[model samples]
Target chain A: MSDSPIVNEFNQGPISCHAFNGDRTELAICFNTNVVTIFRKSGASWTQTSTLVEHDKPVTSIDWAPKSNRIVTCSQDRNAYVWTLDGASHQWKPTLVLLRINRAATFVRWSPEEDKFAVASGSRCISVCYFEEDNDWWVGKHIKKPIRSTVLSIDWHPNNVLLAAGCADMKARVFSAFIKGIDKKPAPSPWGEKLPFNTLCGEFSNGAGGWIHGVAFSPSGESLVFTGHDSTITVVSPGTGDIQSIRAPYLPYLSVIWLNENQIVAAGHDCAPHLFERKGQQWAFSASLDAAVKKADVGFTARDTFRRMDSRAQSTTSTDTEVHTHHQNTINSIRSFSGTPEHVEQFSTSAIDGKLILWNADSISRGLGNLHL
Target chain B: MAFRKIDIDALEEDAFGEDEIDFQEIGELRPVADVDAQVNSRAQEVRSLLQRGNTSGALSTSLQNPPYGAPFHAAKARNTQTVMEVLNSIKVSDVPQLVKSLSPEEQDVLMKYLYAGMAAPEQNNSGHLLAWHEKLTEVAGQGCIVRVITDRRTV
Candidate 1:
């Protein structure tokens, strides 16, 4: 089923970032390299379609605007490019946007409206870029107050006027990106009523002295969830200032998302996505979506011990080399594979292991119990 | 079924107009820091520092405020048995750094614990100690814990 989560293992090398197109039939990924490769889906397998070779440095992040069918990528070389599929040549054409950040541009995201995008950079600023009609080029306006370190991740509010950033400075902040030139004055949201650009609306620390790795706005844009290097997932409700956090028992997760309003899935160094949900008042770990079933026992014998000792000069009872998870390396990015963010039918995860795994949301919820949906 | 690929043809006929980012603050600025969040070590803050290539920072942290639980907590407890128990869990990949990063006095103390652990009665937990011993031997040839043991012997 297209909605079933499947593990696509193409050892292109550790992937730095990846993006799937609107129909979930194509993918744009950087294989920890300067080039961005596009792949097309056949019935079950993906075939390489085209490669966009432009960035002088490794591409850091990529986002595909589903409605607009445009791909924007940022790289460590301090540049961001918007790629369009040329109708004439059937090739992706690149347009460089003026990010104006001196340090590496670390991450990029398209606003929900698709008319604008935000680029997070190592220079401690979020550059919100939009098409300038008179200038005929993408020009960026900088959000520079209060950000102290590299902006690691940014998410656009559903309203398309608010932006949230997770930075290396151990803080996640929400800012208004309402540019007067493009956006109609946005109506008041729970985050705040002020519609001015670069206004720091809400800011919260990741709560464990770790760099914020990822931040995502809840579908309603009322709550913010972020993963931290401290192996924590913290949720904030901007209206009440009520915060809920759960410290994971495994390695820190780099990415996090709300599966629905009640459930959130986060994954990173643990190499597996974990489920968290609120029950009444408190948030708690529910179950591991990628829990590896135990293998049949291969009875311990003298031959196994001798072989193990001969190889490493040590005799241990067990030599289980594999981590008991599906992903062999850190899962970096987790995006909705199928269905909407409000009710994700399937979700896809890409990792440093150069593997893209698509997971069915219902099946995962089934493993835990039943989903309200 | 194979789905449609995304391209310019997939886009709408009319393009959305864009605007320059207005840097001026147009709305009320909320004091965000007042929201409750912290950087407590319960989230493996020390490991985060170590992974970020802040080894010196990690070392100082461990020396200054070692964790009170698993890996660090045992070492933080500062008892010879607890230290050895923590040291025994070190992977071979981290053995060199574990050995190299500690102060000379700390290293000497760790070696003392290792020597003591070597003499402990072999049991189910003995495998890790032996593993650490073997790894230390490989990383430090003659200058490893053996040298410390011998130097103490001569003294």
Candidate 2:
């Protein structure tokens, strides 16, 4: 509940932010004005790394590659652009532009392997593109049922080359990638026979009452959970085709992430982040974040070492004090939280109010820091 | 005995006198060849009519007094069985409309058969049948009867 300048000002504006990698070293912020700013940590201070100014329309979604070397941003201009940063110069530049989409691009995410990325457009199609090193760009994969209902969210499986896409039609489809041999010719009837390259693994009705807004695969990749316009979370076992749905008290506008195997953190239209734990038969809310700590993790500590002069004793003393740092901004999105023995340092979140907050997982309250926009 | 063998053969021939063989035939009941001829002609006429694409009229005429090789009746029976298999796979919600389209006699037969298939073994025969009938009535509604029939006149 510490009131910082970052939170107080962000309470009045609309912005989107994402922390890159588990350490949250790189932060990307997309503003309402259609500009993206990248920030990196230098010493104890955070500084601007680069500003991406390519999209003519407002940016709808932005995602950092799992490697943190590249960023993908999609916009209403019906285009998705990939931006890569130079490690030596700390400069960011757009390297690839995907064009000729039928509708506005809403969301984009890089796959877990960092070899491919998926983009969801308003035209109800999710296009997955693979990066080719020789060509230095992305090429679209052949997809069946190219035109479906509008896709709301697309997420890649944590362990395999599989993708889960949530659509406006209240259905979620799982797509898996397989490599066909070279010189393979197209079959006369693509739909009649199963192709050798790609496979539609499963199509299930997402029991959430309304449009599917967000979908995420657990780190174990055993189950997939999705939330939608309705205030409910549906968990499906991809292995067994079983569905278990839970109702959340508040409607979630954004997404939910698995904190561990059994715990989940969900944030959205609700001002506070809700932490839920799966019990024997139900999901119970374990904790709620403070209004300012929109997307704070459990660990982070900031330590300052300095020499102080005592006025009464007229003596100088050196003291090292450690303070738990927690993010003090409205968190719009969060990714990756890893715990360690000495310190947990891999949780990051973005704020709409113009702050990119990073927290150490071990001591989130004391180890929090922010990169101002 | 050897000396008497030749005389014994001659005596045996003389002892068995030949009887008179008379060949006399009278007409009793005659088999008719005209019946086979009529059947062959009728079959040819039916074949010609079928080849001319007058299957419905041919079938109608054949149904009045069927030809020797009428195969349409057996094919229709097979079609009914196919429809029943398809209906069995349909969801419960769709079964009522499908059963409604059937004729009243077919509806009755299907209802009885389905009820028998679903009835529990321990239940009384009458009770199970009544319960199944009630359920079918609920699904099929009033004034509707499932019927499956082969109208020989129309065939």
User: What does chain B score (TM) in every candidate?
Assistant: 0.38, 0.27
User: What tens digits encode model 2's per-residue C-alpha lDDT throughout A281-321?
Assistant: 46555555433322333223221112123233323222222
Per-model DockQ against the true two-chain complex: 0.03, 0.00
Task: Write one digit per residue (lDDT tens) for candidate 1, span A187-287.
Answer: 89888887688999988864334678999999888899988776678899968777976655456778888888888899888788888887776777788
lDDT of 1 at A175: 96
Give the TM-score (vs. native) of candidate 1: 0.70
Structure candidate 1, residue pairs in collision = A5-A358, A5-A359, A207-B38, A208-B38, A208-B39, A209-B39, B67-B73, B68-B73, B69-B73
In model 2, the Cα lDDT at residue A311 comes to 32
Candidate 1 residue A153 Cα shift, in angstroms, is 0.5
lDDT for position A144 in model 1: 94
Q: Where in model 2 is the C-alpha error above 4 Å?
A: A1-13, A21-23, A42-45, A66-68, A87-90, A142-147, A177-198, A206-208, A291-332, A337-346, A355-373, B1-155
